[model samples]
Target chain A: MGELYRLRRKIEQIIKDGNLDEHQTKGKITLECGLLLALINENTPDEVNALRKLKTAAEKLLGNF
Target chain B: MKMNSLKLKLISLVMACMLANALIIAWLLLDSFQREKNTLAWQALQGAQETYVHLEENCTRTLSATLAALLADEKIAALYQQRDRDKLYRYTAPLFEILKNDFQVTHWYFLEPETAAPAIAQKCFLRVHNAALYGDVVNRVTYKNAVQTKTFSSGKELGKTAFALRVVHPYYHQGTLIGYMELGQEIDEFLSTMQKMTGDAFALIIDKRYLDQTEWKNVRNRKNLPQNWDDMKDAVLINDVLPNKEITRFEGEIEKIPAAGQILEEKQLGKSLYMKGILPVYDAAQRKVGGILILHDITKINSNMKRTLLYSAVSIFVLTLVLGGLIVFVLNRLVFKRLDQMNQTAIRVVGGDYNTKIVPTADDELGQFETLFEQFRNVFVNAVSGIENAESKTIKTKRPVKKRKPRRKP
Candidate 1:
């Protein structure tokens, strides 16, 4: 969790250094960081999808070289 | 530790090409120096031969004229009649004067008839005492070999000066040559006298005869006559080595005898110097009877050449230092340090920093690559973010597209 905060802070600094608003996050930076951390930290799926076959096809496409 | 093979190979290739260029240039210069040296040696030999021919002509003409005058003289005719020591001595005075003044001869002799112990009758006590040491064989009373040796040497002796020079012409009383006028001039004075015709070069008249013995030995300033030399043997050893049988004549810079004039290996001279031109003296029939050696002291030339080589080395060293410094600087800016920074940036990009970029200082291939990679990174970031956002949401149900063709037809 602390590493995640550090990563979030680094991203915010980059945006600020790029001449963006240093105070406002636009709910994008922390959201993207937090969501990716959840995907990495999650042990299993919380809810089952109705179209499991479609979800399986989407995962296969993302993992392919 | 993912190593980039491509960049490493490129660096090695550039270094190999530079080394190859330097090696080729050095080889070319060495080849040029070898070629120049061969040509220079050949030209020097040719020039020495020309000088030899000139020496022969000048000395022979002088001796011939003096001998002709001695033959015609009424005082010299009296030697055949008086046969007394005092009378012969008086008769030989003007002949000596003619040889000394007109011919500029250092010494001359009147050799007696052939006998086991050859009787040496001479005009000057100084000249006679000197020859007496070498014994009567030097006088050559009426030895037929004396005549042959003199006849054989006549042509070659003209151009040079020596401690001993003898010309055997049939001694004429009145109109006919009766006995012989065996004359010798000292080698040193002969060298000086011949200098007129030899162009400041002292011609050392060296017969294969007793050169290592007395006066001739003292004239040359050099070292160890060829390693294999016999003291009593009559061999033409010039500058230590015998003339090569393979070479028709030997003429070039002396390895030891350093002189501007002809160099003779007269070890008796007790002086050490270098001789430039060493020529073979030949008989009338073109037989190499002896050598007319010329000496040129190369001390000055050798010293100057050494200085030139030193300067050349310094110049090459300075140039290489400057070039190497430039190469190091260029390599640092263009290759090593640049690649190192680029490598670190690439590592960061791989660690999921999608906006990561490398700054390129050069406009070369590597710089262009970095620019391209930066562009790809931007496109990649946009695609990933868009895909992730789209994947995380589901679109609501929408009405299907209606066919407008039937309405248009109605």
Candidate 2:
């Protein structure tokens, strides 16, 4: 959980430094990650199941990126 | 179901019940009004008949007293015993005048009692207004176990113009009957008195044979009489106390029925209902002479009852509508209002607002729904939390294990 938080923060910093709003692709990824983390913080059982599905999607995105 | 639909269904049920109740009440009210009208009509008929009976009794009593007083006079008996016509006339003229002035008797007849008839008419005396009538017989008598005075109503004879209430008294000198006297009173005053007492219209009708007109003499044989004349066969009206405006010139047809004691069918004149009752006036020989027809108006009571019933029906309809509206308002407040609130809260909950709360308004069924909804929300929030915890722990450990590189063991 700590490692995932560190990874998420690094991605957030890169997006801020790059002014990701000016870029479409990176801004889209940053927005999705932020929404995913908010859902996780809420930690509803339904959301957790949704997050498990999202993990598979993230793994696929990792290979593509 | 949607709250709006539920509300419409409930209101429809209430309105239907109210309409059914109003219709039932209105029907009952109309039925009661009809019964009341019939009762009023019946009472009016009974009252008219009873009044006629009481009038007849009073007339008989008064006539009896007057005749008794006249017969008790010794001079009258002595003049009759001596068979002195001139002396009797001289002695009775002034006395008859006094009696006529006080008693309102219009005709007096002196008769000799005969074996063939109880009284054979000898001389006729009248008030100053009427000419002295001659040779009118007074043979009306009803014999009982004892001599009893009875009212004798004779129909018109040849040359007789007026109908009267006739009373006959047999006079006795010592132990043998000498002669009988007959007293006559005009029928108009009796009719007037009865009309006043009963508050009804009265008419005395004579046989058409008594009518002077040639057209009425052959009334039964005539083919083309007026439509109104169909019920007035063999009779002619002598007098009536009906209001002038209400008296159709056909007033002559009032008592013109052949049968005795026949209650005619009711007739309606505008808003007024008229019922006619025919009572036969019999001749001393028990022959049907004429009839007394009483017309009673029972319209006022009938109209009043109908008006009251209409007002009551209208009031009930208005009250039902008001009560129905009140029921709708109460349902909106007590049931639909709470249901709407619950619906709004449920919508918010579905929209992921877990904090949305439903409060119970009563300890009834809806309140139970609120409690169940609250429990569902708690369980849902807890379940969401459990899912998040399990996913987070699983993802963190799997990622670390993946990071530990597998030995390049292709």
Mind giving the per-residue lDDT tens digits that candidate 1 earns over B1-410?
23676555655565566556555655665565545444443344445566545544566566656666765677655754455545665656655776677655655555453421234432222232233432233423322444554431343232221333444455556454344554544334444444444332433333444344443444443443333233224443333221222121333322322322333332211232233445555443444455444443333444555575566556655666666666766777787777776665544443345555677677898899778877776785676567645544422223246676655554
- Model 2, B11-122: lDDT tens digits are 8899999889988988887888767655655565567567766765666567667777777788888886786666777777777788678877766656665432434433
Model 2 segments more than 4 A misplaced: A1-65, B1-6, B30-43, B78-102, B116-163, B205-235, B244-314, B384-410
| Regions more than 4 Å wrong, model 1 | A1-65, B1-53, B78-86, B101-163, B168-182, B188-296, B328-345, B356-372, B390-410
TM-score of each: 0.52, 0.61
Which window of ten consecutive residues has the lowest lDDT sum in model 2 chain B? B142-151
Model 1 residue B198 CA deviation (Å) reads 9.2
What is residue B160's positional error in candidate 1, in angstroms? 19
Q: TM-score of model 1's chain A, to 2 decimals? A: 0.34
